[model samples]
Target: MKVHFIAIGGSAMHNLAIALHNKGFEITGSDDEIFEPSKSRLEKYGILPKEWGWYPEKLDTSFDAIILGMHARIDNPELLKAQELGLKIYSYPEYIYEQTKDKTRIVIGGSHGKTTTTSMVMHALKDNNIEFDYMVGAQIEGFETMVKLSQESKIAIFEGDEYLSSPIDRRPKFHLYHPHIALITGIAWDHINVFPTFENYLNQFEIFTQMIQENGSLIYFDEDEHIAKIIKNKREDIEYIPYHSHPFKIVDNCSILKTNKGEIPLEIFGEHNLQNLMGAFHICRKIGLSDESFYQSIQYFSGAAKRLQKLADKNSCTVFQDFAHSPSKLKATTEAVKKQFTNRKLIACMELHTFSSLKKEFLPHYKNTMGSADEAIVYFNPKTIEHKKLEPITKIQVAEAFGGNNVTVYTDSDQVITDLLEHDFNHTNVLLMSSGNFSGLNLIELAEKIVNKY
Candidate 1:
């Protein structure tokens, strides 16, 4: 199959391109600019575009399909050309559905925890010698690529993102993957630019539950009031299984899961992670994995990348970096670290990077979210607001929004780093959280410097 990709330098798009290429399909892709990792990986497959930017001449009717990325604009030249030629075109998720239509599709969806939960299922499946096609949002350990497709696999697991599929496709990516089995980790208001209101943001999931294939099952976190309310009147044809945090205890900063076989120690921790573990448990059981097998396999699972990933550790001082920008994620991650290291001082730092977190109106949602930290720091770049075309927000506004005397807001990345450097790393656990890199701050290097200081 000849598949052409527009704006293929995206994290997910490039991974999909590589997956299709590895499957022995003819792959061609272009982007205005390609960054490291994506650029090198695409080149390694010998499918990297010779030149950057869209080429109208490159669009041909002979191409079997055109996969569009969210990075592409609605008026992308190649997209317009493809539309003009009347060729088959699909958003990323739409194409994924087409590929897995015959397979048992299992989709994990929510504002948060979807990636980690999906990774857990993938880890278990692989460990138990199950062959399956899968697509997860993050680069997981033991997985060559985030997007994997195999002709032999009878099942497909997908990390269901609620974002728009592509520039031209307004449908949520998860909605297109009409799953035979589904999991909703939890619902939290996000993507303020798209959905606007909390109710509007929530209705998407309500629609998603209804889209599940007839006689399919929905495994959801019952603790979330919004999720509970939505599923209360769910489709009678579909089965609903509610889950909560698995039975676990923190011992010497290690989280141990209580299973039927025995107490299994976990590499991942927190109430949110325990909740995710339960969701993964139910999904794995539906996929024919026994409880014992799932528990055994999950013991080796560390975590999905950037979900409270340990960056550097020295003595009692450990540094963690998490992709947590949303209010709920920030709270959960902060509390998780604090709960784990109960006796240690916690320094929770987060970057206000995403569209939702940068918005002045959305700031109040973060009220007291970082209260678990002994010292809380919030960082935002004013220039980033201008680049996103968002209204400028002040450090004072951020401090007030977070509404805590311990919260210290910074507009400069250098200053934040400087302040962090000055702190003594005796028994303090530092948690750096953000969806972005704090305006191009190299976190790994920063973590090294912090760790070396001790």
Candidate 2:
């Protein structure tokens, strides 16, 4: 297979490029700008573009397919060349479908927990000696790349993102993957820039469920009210399996899952994690994994990168870093850490980085979301709002929106780092949550400083 990628330096695009390269396909990709990790990883595979900018002269009819990324504009030179030549083009998920169409596809989608749930299934399957192609949003410990594809594998697992696909293809990504097995962990309002409203955001999931292949199964979190409402319009052509949080107890700060045969100790702790685990378990079972094997493999699963990642533990203080910017994600991460470490002073710091979180209209959804944290610190760069071209907001509005006098807001990055380091972290636990780095704050370094490691 010969594939050319436009805007290939994207998180998903680069991984797919690497995966295809590994599959022995001739791969070539172009991007105007490529950052660390993506640039380095592509270079290691010997497929990194020598020139950064897209060139129309790089294209021809010899290419079997053109994969477009969301980062690329509709007028991208390479994309225009591909279209001019009338070559087939695929969005990230669209190409994934073309590659895995013959295989059983399991897509996990939700506003939250999809990455963790998808990672859990991938780790368990690989741990049990199962060969499978998979794609997840976050990196997993045992996996070398975020996207993997193989001819020998009979199943493919994907983290189904609801965000728009290519700039040209406005459809949500998950809509393209017609999954034989689909699981939605839960739903909450997010991506207000594209989705505009809760109903509009929700309609995408409804369309995704409807896109399931005939005789496919829909595994969902029954506890979510939005999901509950969706399942009301159930289909007879597919089987529906609803799951809730698996029975677990916090033991010695470790999460333990209760099973009929025995209790399994887990490295991950959180109610949302427990629910994610259950969602993964159901997907595993459908693929013929025994309950015993599932629990055994899952016991060793640490977590997907940046999802409740432990950064420091010393002097009776623990620091957790998570990719949680949405209100639901923020609420869940804060609650989980506080519940598990009830004795400690829970200081939660979050960055209002995403377009949704920075918007004035979306602020109210965050009301009381961080109440579990003993100290709630919110950070946002005013310039970020300007960059997004949004209406300017105030620290007062942010503080009030959180519905707490405890909620403190900051516009400066260094001040946040300074205050966190200055505070006495002894017998305290800190949760740093955001999709973006707190305006280039090195969180790992920050965590180490909190524990006196640096």
Q: Per-residue alpha-carbon lDDT of model 1 for 347-413, expressed as tens digits? A: 9999999899999999999999999999999999999899999999988899999997999999989
Candidate 2: the clashing residue pairs are: none
Q: Candidate 2: TM-score?
A: 0.99
Q: Where's the lowest-lDDT run of ten residues in candidate 1?
A: 227-236
Mark the 10 consecutive residues where model 2 has the least summed lDDT: 445-454
1-454 in candidate 2: lDDT tens per residue? 8999998899999999999999999999898999989999999999999988888997999999999989989888888888899999999899998899999999999999999999999989988999999889988998899999888999999999999988888999999999999999999988899999799998999999999999999999998999988889799999999998999988777788899969999999999999999999999999999999999899999998999999988878999999999999999999999999877899999999999999999899999999999999999999999999999999999999999767989999998887877788877999999999988988888888888843
Q: Candidate 2 regions off by >4 Å?
A: none
